[model samples]
Structures are given as C-alpha cells and as structure tokens.
Target: MGNQPMIVMSEDSQRTSGDDAQSMNITAGKAVAEAARTTLGPKGMDKMLVGSSGNVVVTNDGVTILQEMEIEHPAANMIVEVAQTQEEEVSDGTTSAVVVGGDLLGQAEDLLDQDVHATSIEQGYRQASEEAKAILEEQAIDVGADDTELLEQIAATAMTGKGAENAKGRLAELVVDAVTSVADDAGVDTDNIKIETVVGGAIEDSELVDGVVVDKDRVSDAMPYFVEDANVAVIDDALEVAETEIDTEVNVTDPDQLEEFLDREQEQLRAMVDDIVDAGADVVFAEDGIDDMAQQFLADAGILAVRRTKSSDAAQIARATGAQVVGNVGDIEADDLGFAGTVSQQSVGGSQQLVVEDVEDASSVTLLLRGGTEHVVDEVERAIGDSLGVVRITLEDGKALPGGGAPETNLALELRDFADSVGGREQLAVEAFADALESIPRTLAENGGLDPIDSLVDLRSQHDAGQSSAGLDAYSGDVIDMETEGVVEPLRVKTQAIDSATEAAVMLLRIDDVIAAGDLKGGQIDGDDGGDDGGPPAGAGGPGGMGGMGGMGGGMGGMM
Candidate 1:
C-alpha cells in the first residue's frame, strides 16, 4: 500500500478558472468603462490621445478613444466592441452604451460576491434589457423627414458636447438641409451628400451647395472658368489613346514614320474630344488622365474639363448632373450627357475648387465646412457626421426620445418594480441591474460637476411621480423634462445601447475560465531553462491584482 513517490501533472498553458477568472474579467471590463465614463454627457470633457507617431487626436467620442487605445485584455476588447456596435447602429450614444455595460458587470460582481449563480444574473439582465427596450418604445416620440425643426433639434442634441458646440445651431441647420435635400423614397441616402472641409474661414461661414463640389479646378487656364447651362459628360476612362496591353516596339526608322505615328496618336485624342463635342457636352469629368492634346481640343471647343477626378467625386457629379458615366468615349451620345445649371471654377477658402451649382431637381448635394484650424475642421467633420447620422435615423425609424438620461432613469424606476415581483436570489440580480441603469444619469450629473447622489435622488423622485420624461439638466443641475427642453435623440440609440450593453455584460458573466498560451516564440514565459525573474505569475496581474470595491469605487468617484 506504499507508493514509491507522489507525482503531479501540469500543463504549460496558463489557466485562470472559477472566481479568479470572473474577477479578472470584471476588473478589465470596469477599467474600460472607467476610462470612458468621464466623457458621458453634454458637459463631458474631451480626451487628447497622442499616438506613437506623435499624431494627436482630441475627442470625447467613445469609439474614437477606444479605437486609439492599445487594449490588450480580451475582456476589455469585448467592451470596445459594445461601443463599436452602438456607433454602427445609432451613430451616437457609444459612450453611454460602454459605460452602461461596464456598470452591469460591476453590479454582477457584487451579486457574485453574495454567492449568486452566474446563470441567474444572466437571466435577470436579459429580462431587464427586454423591459428597457419596451420602455424606450413606449417613450418614443414620432418624427418625419419633412419636420426640419425636429431634425435640427436632433442634430443639436448630438453636437452639444462636441468641439463644434458653439456653432451647433448653424451646423445643425446645414446638416438638416443636406440630409433632406438628398432624401429619396427609400430614405435618406447619406452617401449622396458629400462633405468638404477647408481650413481658414469661420465656422459660421460654412454653407450647403445645391450641387456637387470638386476639389480640382479647371485642368488648364485656357479652359473656360464658367459655363452656364452646362452639358456635362462623366468619362470613367482615359481621354488619351488606349495603351497596348503588352510590350512592343513601333520600329519607326524614319522621321516621316515618326511624324505619322505622333499625328495618329493626336488624331486619336482629338477624335475622343470630338465625340464629346458632338454629344453636345460643354463640361467633362475624366476619371483618368486627359492628354494635353485633348485638353486643347476641349478648350478650343469652349468646353471646361477636369482631369483625374476621384471616382467618388465623379459619381457624385453624375448624380448631381443626371449624367451616365461612360466607360468608353465611343459609347457617349447626346442623351448620355448630364446637365447642370452652372459649372464654374472659383477661389474658395484660398483654394481652387470646381463648383457645380443651381442644378434643377438635383438629388445630391454638398456641404462645405469651414474652420480656422486643421483640428477644428476635423472635429467639425466628426460632429457633422454624428448629426447627419441621427437625422437619417430619425427619418428612417420615424421615432425619437428625450435625451439627458430621462429614459434610463425611467427604466430604472420600472425595473425596480419588476424586481419586487420576482421572489428569489434572481431578484437581487434584477435589482442590481436596475441600479446599473442609474449610472447614466449619475454619470451625466457627475460629469457636469453636480453631486451624483443628490441629482439621482431628485431624478428618482420625479420619475416616481408619473413624470417619466423628467431627466437631469446637466447645464443647470436641476430635474427637468428633456423633451420639453428640446434635448432629444433617436429612439434606436437608446434601445440599441441597452441591448448591446446587456448582451456584452451577460456574455462576460458566463466566462469562468481563461487559458493563455505561453509565448514560446518570445522565449520569455516558456524559457528552456525555466528561468524565473522572481516576478508575478502570468495571470497574477489580473483580477487578483485589482484592489477591491473600495479602490475601484474611489477611482470611479474621482470621475465625478
């Protein structure tokens, strides 16, 4: 009955299981949330992220911050995906979604500490998320494409905390005009609305063009700068003679043969120009290089030409001018030509740009954004992107809800009631989920320099009295109805945020094991000699290293 010796087997891979794994994942999730929670509402601050190459990006947008960071933790990456999904679906509310997801995990950790099963927490969160979605649908207000005023409000709501907040009113109007101008029976076609930004002018000087804007000016000074009632042709191919597919020698032994070859090439180029002129076109957009001879022919025929136009710009021009882009010049005809009321080359913001304006029944348009600096222009572009996205969402979904965390507070209130009806340990998880929903308004108040506890208390009182639309007034630090105050967002944003945040939190809760392969190629963790640096183990720095609730709560409290 005596064993020679006791032997144990071990694997090379580093594995973290049970409570240790859950703690690590939750800590990582909360760290990600803590990073973005500071940038939550209208009063949120911006982050200046400097890259390894010294490139700098200053933004409060959640997706930009997460994308720029080099996050290594797998659980943290999942949180980043939540923000990405929010941005993709609603184009705004990314920060809120991520923060809420982090809070959900934080709350689940508390329940786990109380010995609650992970499955019960997951089930409770799923039920709570469904209830939240239903609540958002019930709280939504109707919107339509024809309602420009409402659309402007939506844009302003998105741009409130962005760098362009000062000029949000003007930019919102321009965004609304551009989206409505390009809207079709299918809905708003945002691609058809091009945005061109140039640094120098004030933000107030930005304007919307009823037609397209090409960055390229006239190809030659001899070309006409302005053509009225222009007949435009979009050529997707080169205006020069087609090149031979394979290498060849012309074998021109005499000057006469050389002259004939040169003249033949010129004739070919001239014939291409002649085809356009015969088609009754006064302006041409060539997607590839236009030979010098062709330009001379076009100019001599009183036609304006732009060469090497970007494919996107060319498609936009065709849309604005009602032209069909022809792959071959020989296929072009008068009927294939497009029309524009005026095609002119002008000096705009110290740059030469081709302006195609005053087109009748034009379905495509452009917005020229002006600013005093490169950073300003970049921020303006981001702000306008969000604005346009919300406008499109409102047009397509035809519904919206009050912003400033009103819907979230209402969900918290209703979820608490729902939690009371459930009689089990799962009820504790449901109650935790309700408390997690309050992080939004609490964050908004915290970011706005108000006492989160005081603000949340007042908000709860207001929502409990049947005033569900009541939300925090970040500016004044008062409880007020966001809907009545003109602070609103697309309904899809709220529903998607709740759905994505809950899904991420639930998925993370079910992860109880983490296995990491040793880096043999790096020769650090899996050394041949088994050399140890007396350092912590591979997974030691994970949740085991995380300071408990007090430490994390202190970190989060500092954000307020």
Candidate 2:
C-alpha cells in the first residue's frame, strides 16, 4: 500500500468525449459550410476577405474563400477537405457541396439530440446519397461534345455568378472553341488547352489562338518581325561554342595565337547558325541561350529566333508545329523542322509575347484571356476553368442535368417518398436528409434577396406537381423550368457533390471523441506563446477563419 501511488494526467493532453465532442465537431463542420454557403448560386453575395497585410479578396468562389480562411481545429479541417475535393473533382459546385455537408451535420445533430443513433443517421445518409446518384442519372439529359449551343449554356451557367458574367457570351464562345480545337476522339486533355491572361483589354478581346503563345521576345532586334511559312527548329542544345568536358588551360602568349583563338570561337558560333540555316530552318526556338555571334548570324540570315524558351512552351510549339526538338545542331535535318504560317512578336500587357499562329494540323491551342484588371483576370480564369472542367466531364459522361437548384428540389421531393419506404429510425434520417437537400434552394433564394421559405415552398409545390425541371430563377426570384431556360450543369458535378458531401458528413458524424495535445510552448489550448511570429492573421483559421471562438453565436453568423 505504501509503494502504490496515484497517477495524474497532464493538462497538455486534453480529451472531449460523447456529446461534447460531437457537438463541437458538428458546430465546426456547420461553420465551415456556412462560410461558403452564401457564395452559392448566381445571386450569391461575394465575400470581401481582408488579410492582415491589407490585401483584399472580393470573390464568390467557394474554393477560394475556403482556401483563404485560417482554420486550426482538426474537425473543421476535415470539412475544408470536402470543399477541396469538390474543387479538385469538378472545379465547380464547391459551395453547394459544402453547404449540403453542413446541412447534413446540422440535421444529424438534431437527430442525435432526439436520441437517434449516429449509426442510423449515417446509414440513412449513405442510402440517400446512393438514391441521389440514381436520381441524377435517371433525370440527366444526354449531351454531345459537338453540341455548341448547349455547351455555351453550360459555360454560361458556370460563369453566371462571377466577374465574367458581363462577358459570359463572348467568353463561352472562346472556351468552347478552345476546348473543341484541342479535343480529339480519345478525350479532352485540358493540359493542351492553355489559358493565357493579360490584364489590359476588355474581356471581349479574349480570343482563342490556334497555336501556343509564350511570353518571350525575339533574340535580337535585327531579326524579322514576322516569319511566314516558316521552317521551325526547336534546339535543346546551346548555340554557344562547346567547351572541353575536361578542364584545361590554353596559355596563348602570342598575340596572333590569342586572335586566332577568338576568331575560332566566333567561327564556331557562326557555324552553328550556318548549320541551322543549312537545315532550311527559318525560325529558331532555343531551349538554351544563343551566343551573340550566332544571334547576329541568324538575324542576318532572316531567321526569327527566340532564345531560352521554357521547356513546356518548347514542347507545346513542337506539338503545334509538327517540329522535332533537336539536341544537336549538326543532326538537324529538313524533316526535323516544323511548319507555321506566322511566328511573330507582339507586345501584350506591357510585355513582349511570342505568338506562334496558324500551324497546319495543330494539336495544341491557347485561350488568350484579357480582362480590365488583375482581379477580373483571375476571376475570368476561374470561370473558364470551371467551364472547361464542366465540358470535359459532360463529354466524358455524356450526361447533364438542369441547374438553378432544380436537381436539389427534385432530389428532396423524391427522397421524402423514398423515406416513407425506408420505415425505421433511419427513416427519420432519410427525411432529415430530404430536408437538408432543400437548404440549397433555400440558401439560393436567400442569397438572391427573396424569401427563402416562400421560394422553397413554391418550388416544393411545383416539384410535387410533376414539374421535374422547375427551379429558382435567382435573377427574377421566381421558380422556372431550368431546362427551358437553358440552365444546366454536368451530371458529374451533381453526383460528385452529393457523394463528397455525404461522405464527409458521415465521417464527421461518426466521431464522438477528440483528443488534442495542448501547446508545447504553453499549457493552454491554442494559446499563443510569447514567440508568435504573426505569420498569418490571428483571426484566420486554417481554411476558413469561420471559427471565431464565439461558440454558438459565431457559428450562426457563418450560416447566414
């Protein structure tokens, strides 16, 4: 008895179990979801995030806002991953996915409060998710890659809420053209579809380039401004004279010998240009530097040359021009050269860019994106990216669905009927899932400044009457047939959103315990040590500074 001693736990290791942990997790997850919810739909409001450095971001992009937040809680980080996965998979619908995830947790929390088992709620959600996928597949409309009008509608749908909304028509045309030009029977490779942004002109000036554009200038002013029907040579080797691999010293004491040495180097450089000229190459894209003498010779020979081109751009040019990248100048043959109608230098946005245009049988293409400012340019890029992703997914799956919350309303109305057949404590969860799904349209209505309940009630009534395509029109604050209105989204986007959100929510709901190690520098939880570097703003959380330590009040603010 005397040798037995009591053990004490250190405060550094903190643990929360049962209801406390679940409540904290639910609250955190919901906060993250609410952070992005307001940014959903066409009429969604933009968030003005001001960083500690006074840098401001005014955006409605879910991924961007989530990424900009500073979240530290582990549970909240998991919720952030849902948004990131949505972005990675579809490049759109991030906000909707997060909102649905939050709503699911909110519903589950209510079920937990009612003494319903977490396992039952999770099972119900999983079942509803599977059912949602089936509904999406059954209701989806078929689309082909060649359907230009529908593709434009898809593109315009993606850009409706953002900065590119004003120029969506012109931008959609450019996106479709660029995507189709680079697409073959196999599939669309977005890598071949490059978006080059220049912040100077209006979005209307944005156009598609048949070939690649590199932000590079010609090697010398003496070179021709433009080369037509040019024989393009892509040299990976340097134009400078090669030095001996083994280090050696040439001690030339005689003046004539030194002059001979200098002349030999000049001749070597000149010979390199001679070799390129002999290959019948009229344009040179050197992956490495071109010597001064070689540049002069190429200019005198009327060969347009760009030195030190990026390796990726070099390969892109090769693909577009049907040229081979030559490692040695001596081995460059006529067949190694590529053909391009014009290779010219143009000044864009106060910088020189080498424009390689009108290549025969080109496989690669570029979208020259121009906008009024940097912010507009960034937002425009995001819009085009979303369009490309949507188009690619639609082409691959050959399916699309009506947008403007029609799919959500349809899923909700159908889920309730399915819930009746479920018939268990799980049925409550299914019904809850149905209710959760309606939050999308409700939030959309609210963001559009309409009465959310009224809009949702009207939507539910329409869907009940067999109006499958009925959806909230944010612009007019009325429910309309999305299909007739030309509002559509990729089936993959909807299905993926449901799967990702449900999976994340289920994972969060199953957790009933949390153990965290307190700060090593101090004994407090999340407390700053005296050595705080002030790297990121103190208020910012990891992904979304949505958690303000305000407990319930802060969480509610995030939802609104």
Specify the highest-TM-score model's number. 1
In candidate 2, position 86 carries an lDDT of 85
Q: List model 2 lDDT by residue over 220-300, tens digit each.
A: 999998888888999999999887999999999999999999999999888888899999999999999988888899999
Each candidate: RMSD to true structure? 5.6, 5.2
Candidate 2 global lDDT? 0.83
Count the clashes in each prediction: 0, 8
lDDT leader: 1
**Candidate 1 lDDT tens digits, 26-71:** 8768777877898889899987766656677788999987777655
* Per-prediction TM-score: 0.88, 0.86
Range of the 10 consecutive residues with the lowest summed lDDT in candidate 2? 520-529
What is the number of residue pairs that collide in model 1? 0
